[model samples]
Target chain A: MADEDATDEPQGPRTTTAEIVPLRLPPVADEEPEPLEDPRTGDVDEWGRSERVRALVRKAYDPMYRNWFRAEWDGLDKIPTEGGALLVANHAGAIPSDAPTIMHGVETELERPVYGLADHFFKSAPVVGTLWSRTGGVVAHPDNAYRLLHDQNQLVLVFPEGSKGPGKTYNERYRLRRFGRGGFVEIAMRAGVPIIPIAVVGAEESMPILFKVPSVARALGAPYFPVTANMALGPLGALIHFPAKFKLRVLDPVTFPDVEPDQPRYSRSRIMDESEAIRQQIQEALFDMLRQRRSVWFG
Target chain B: MGRRVLVTGLSTFWGGRVAQALEADPDVDVIIGLDTREPTVKLERTEYVRSDENYSILSRIVKATGVDTIAHTFLVVDSTTMSSRAMHEINVIGTMNLFAAASAAGSTVRKVVVKSAALVYGSSPKDPYWFRETDRRVAPARTRVERSLLEVESYVRDFARDNPHVVLSLLRFCNVVGPDITTPLTRALRLPLVPKVAGYDPRFQLVHEDDVVAALLFAIDREVPGIYNVAGDGQIPWSEVMTIAGKRGIPMPPFGIGLATDPLQRLGLVDFAPEVIDLLKYGRGIDNRAFKDAGFAYEHTSAGAVEAFVQAMRLRDTVGSDEVDYRYEEDVETFFRHSPAVVRDTPPS
Candidate 1:
């Protein structure tokens, strides 16, 4: 292996295993630092620094990068303590910002941290791409979801309303986006966890979506919002961050009975119907709480 | 010329007083009071039993005292908003036990007169028509207690139909008020700013104890069977009743006190039970034309009953205070249950 790298940057020859072997090790100071804790288990003694550095970078982007938009949480106690949780909240706000707010809610009120499924755009930016890997925020794919929850014992938070959530016009603010698919319910059923209904009141007003940009979507190779309509021509997106008081009421957890880990998962249709019911319950509770002006805002 | 009579539920307000009155009568040779409780009041010719073995007790009493005739004024009212199962145990099962025991004894038990509430006349406020024995069966409004009352009525009717020999008399009473009364009426009277909800316009006709007692005696004398409306002869509005109570120095509260907790009086919990809410929302102010036509005379008017209650309050020094007087504490429990079936069976600690 040492004899293979006769020159730097290997002349126009097919790469051999020996040539690549020398490039693997680096000076101690140049190496990326170890993660303070594992993203999955938070264990330090097992994994290498490169893996830890990736996790650290992801962790750093969460608060700072996400804080670029205003968010709030209320009644975070509804998250369960030990088992995997399926958090179903109303999806609104451009780029579906309620996800981070929900993560913060569970993390702050509950001792456990939540793993959010970020859209494909976060990975499109190289810096954001690295951050996603280290922080454990995946590509928000449907197939990887069930495995993430069932195996990891982490709280799975999803808007369920998808892209239609944040793109809802101002007239539809506070009204929830339609829950198109029910895969979240199936994941919860398979994992045998309680579905926690969360009502996010302030997200819609944060970065209101006026219109979708098909051109920007093509350029970025993403199907969802290219630029928040509030940000399209400018100042409105900044104005939208008016520190709106947000109330998140964690409703009583709805648990599906008799689903064992070894048993077959629930059908997509049944899960979808159950999820819609859970969402409706949250919406009704939110309307009642908000109409009563009984929000428990942090600020 | 001696008349023998057997009475069950004599520890109840109506039955207890009736038992006391019957035992005092010189013409009544044997007065056997069958109760689930040990008979506390003593009478010269009266024997008491604390068990519901009505037939066995009646047979034993008749064998001892040569009782030739039996008359019962057994009544059980569901005063709490418990589950139907609990209500059935106390009201249905308990009544069934009494009736079974009485039947097995083959004593001269001839007639059983029950005291029932006129609230069964359908708790609807618009019950402007006078309720008769033949009136349609009013579906029990939502309160579990009211439903329980209806269940008790059903049992009585069913038992009466099954036993052709045993005569059954049902005395349906309206708001029976007297001084020292802790009824829902009295409680509402004490509320400050009580709401007369749009649909709940209570035109209450409160019966006096004297009149109610008179009606019971009337039933005993005539051996009246079937149902009869027994109450005072006035259609007094709930507001007017409150005014009368206020004039008598009873606090006419302007609002409902039971919706929130009243610290000094834990009694509100019992008063505001869901059953009572059903009674409040829909109970009709009953007509007492049946008893009146049966030659049953009412000595005390509705106003007189209110006056007597206020006077009793003054005598007990509970005229204005909401606190329970030690002497009347047992009465409150008896009055709340409206049943000798409850108090007679349990020993007072």
Candidate 2:
């Protein structure tokens, strides 16, 4: 089995020869082929969002969007029809109808897809996750946000308060939660996209959380188990909304001109300041919209 | 003098394919393949050396052969093929010994290309839509395969750090599917009823087997160092994959799925490895742009790979596997490679 002689005898003088053979060759410039056709059987995209599903959802949800919520948008023109922008909204209600209302309104009005960046908690559930993904719900990861905002150049709607905004009691309605350590600001800064603050009214009254049972939430492994005023109707109330009017106002786009995009890290104080400023702008807008409101159901 | 390369796992599908590919490369003069078993594929000039599962004799072989490039393809990513103990031996221990041999004092090896799987990134609901090369797993590995692969990667990282002069490229390939390769996913897809977790349709990123070999060769040909994700362009949902295969899916219960699959596994109905189950739940997507930026072109997308596999399946169903079963005969191979009476094509250098 001493076969080294057979292999090595042909190639003589291994030492000087080793020096001539380069360890790393110059990379061969492969002729780039025309992109192959993706043989996909479904419309689900790389982000799991499906346009066909989104369109179908819009068709079915249009009635509820127009009638039940009566979702109305102000300063919708302020949102750029093209290019990427982070749509920051104040979340409310036990189920938080604002995300869908805002997404449905922007998508229908702008005639563009709007990806709702939600908690990964939605992704953990089986049917809900699949439905959420098909209807344009993306997990609110910084990378996911950056890719959507910068790479794909799509509109992304995120509630800065996360589950905290909706998980609060009915008395805490319209009060904005802390904006999640300003991660959204950092992501927008990294993506170099402007943050468009959207203030919403009547989401608080739609499915108001009377109180939350932490024990039940813990048992169910949920963020919060809410006892909503809508639940007084029946078990179906969990899915039903109280027919509260939804009025949404898209605030001016906030651009971080001073900071460079794609930075490894941003100034902590700068992120906090920018995050607080955006929160305050949305809070004030909500109060302004609420002051002009006649009735929760009527808006 | 041309390149002398050492390929691990000569009998395994990847190792045999890689060795065969290297044999076709005129630049690579000497090809030595190491595995516990004999080479499974036909080769002309490559030399196969039998070694134990842990490759304890790798250092001696490395020194004797003076191989400059080592293509480590032996790491077992499929846990169903062996026991956890054997997998640990092959993946973790074998990798440790191989790296040890390569990075030894006065070692001739300068470049190392590791064929790693994207399973190192454990699939979880919290995972980003796309995992960059630098992204860590959202959760720790739960299965033996993932854990073992992770361990092998750590050794690769350490070897790279210790031997900075050695150009090391770690190619993390996503779920590979094509006409030839038989992975857990492919096996499941080939079943009469493709098993899926109930109410969960996760998107999967797939690469064709040809692209996988091409990526490995590309890494060897170029000086592209660092971790590069080797996958096709886009992701396809599991349901769409079954649809492309022209097969219906049978949903496995979402809860206690491991317990549910045990009986089927014993009955040879389905081979749902624990890692694959997690993959079927919250599928993985790796960022393949880094490899593309490194100038490797992929021939198939996620869906295209499935299409290729399905097309092959259709043909196989009609013709019943046209592959000629070639067995390795040591005496015949030795005579062809070493016998003095045999006429040489290249005139002995």
Candidate 3:
């Protein structure tokens, strides 16, 4: 009786019965006989940049960038709308959450992908290692930076302070560390790209470290192990953080023409001069933002 | 009277194909295929000579034919498949004999072309991204095949000095893959599962068997003055290669691999040597720009070569181990017979 009723009810085309269509991926390039070029496809680029993993990470961190922090980015226009560029900034906090934010900020605004170069230690960590590479974080080295800026025409972000800035305690917050030996200037000069200084405020308050345990740091093979106020409260302490509003200010970009840094005319003083100029610009931006802010917690 | 050419080791696959390639060419020439054993493939229009390179045998052939070009394709890297004595005689002594004959014949032998392996670079953590011909050929002292090839290269280099009239050329091939290839590497990749170093993902450069023949033919037609490292440029990490080969890669620690593969090796299930394990960790890469500058183009990259091998594997339920059986430490029958009796009703005879 049920079969006869079903047959009697369905007099129309069988298309209506299709609740879910079988997913079909179109054959790669029509199955034609054209040869395949060595293309950077799927998840990763030739330099190990992964779009899929970057997208997944962006989705996971959207809440932090959008709601809890309420981050506001200013001077987006200072970043070139096209071509290669470098965004040099001061890094802070145990976890460099600002790195990803700055990266996503510029990339999303320009509708282009940006690369972040971090310390080699990050690549040795378990889960963060994979996440770092997939989200376009390269192991910080001259060759890696050269390849990104020059060969790939990428917007690479570098923290000249190395690991010192991010591991700073709350007492030393907002104090700029020494930029290492003007490497970024040489890179920008060679790549023929401009360097845009970025000043990120309230990043130091994200994960305030009261003290560090050397023994724990040694055991975990980490550079420094921080005992934050929240971490001191115990395991559940990490579940919540004191929300600090983030204000990002981009300084004017400075550029040097594409020239070899080794020439006798392009002495070490000239490169250092370029580096110091950019450093001063970032320091001014930080002080300006600090003065304008009424409260650190409210931005 | 014409530009006579003689190809040694006609019994081998590379030798057979090279001879066939020369036989079809319209360039004024005569083709002579010389070997002791019968060829593995049919040699059309190639005059086969059944003789060893012993004493006066090869010298007489070189003299009587007045063969100006000699293509030596007998270099072997996988030594596990053959008897130790046979391998040394063919790879070491046979080369000495051929060079002696050519050296004695002097200017009559116009050219000596060797098909060599790029294993001379040796897999190392310190190796460059791509090895140029000018880079040092630094193989470990214990690596016998590579050490022996170095010996042959020295001889070839000396022969070039002694017999300067002969245009000597060397082609060092990277890993080779194709449908007709039956080497230890290809056979290992054909396995259902392969082991990789847990954290080490080394890049691989595989030249197709056809590209190897094509380069050999170019050496035959023109006099390439120096050594050339021949490999397709489609370099990628082994993990990606495993993805392409459709094989499940089990990541094992470098030392832990011994515990897993030792029993398999002892049982003759897996033929990967210790050096091969290192290859999986720090694979080899060779620069083929010199060949490109010489007006030769490769039709298959490393990826294309691997894809062809995978396609051939899909066509057959399983790849046969007939020609590749010699690549192990023990005989097939001995391996099956020693297999704990419970697993074997009848050992393969």
Q: Which candidate is the best by DockQ?
A: 2
Candidate order by lDDT, decreasing, is: 2, 3, 1
Per-residue lDDT for B204 in model 3? 77
How high is each candidate's TM-score?
Answer: 0.43, 0.95, 0.65
Question: For the second chain of model 1, what is the TM-score against the true structure's chain B?
Answer: 0.73
| Residue B22 alpha-carbon offset, candidate 3, angstroms | 4.2
lDDT tens per residue, model 3, A1-299: 87434422312212211121111111112233345344212445444456777777778777878787778989889988777788899887777668978877776678788888877666544345545756887667665576567766788999988778877788888888888888888878867778899999877888777778889988887878887766766797754555678899888888665565334244579789888888888888898899999987788
lDDT of each residue in B222-332, candidate 3, tens digit only? 657689999986576676677778888777765557578779977887676655776776566787878767655676777777887777777665655435332322234
Query: TM-score: which candidate is best?
Result: 2
lDDT per residue, candidate 2, A171-192, as tens digits? 8888999999999999999999
Comparing 1 and 3 by lDDT, which wins? Answer: 3
| DockQ scores of all models, one per candidate | 0.00, 0.39, 0.03
> What lDDT score goes with residue B6 in model 3?
88
Isolated chain B TM-score per model: 0.73, 0.97, 0.85
lDDT of each: 0.56, 0.88, 0.72
Ranking by TM-score, best first? 2, 3, 1
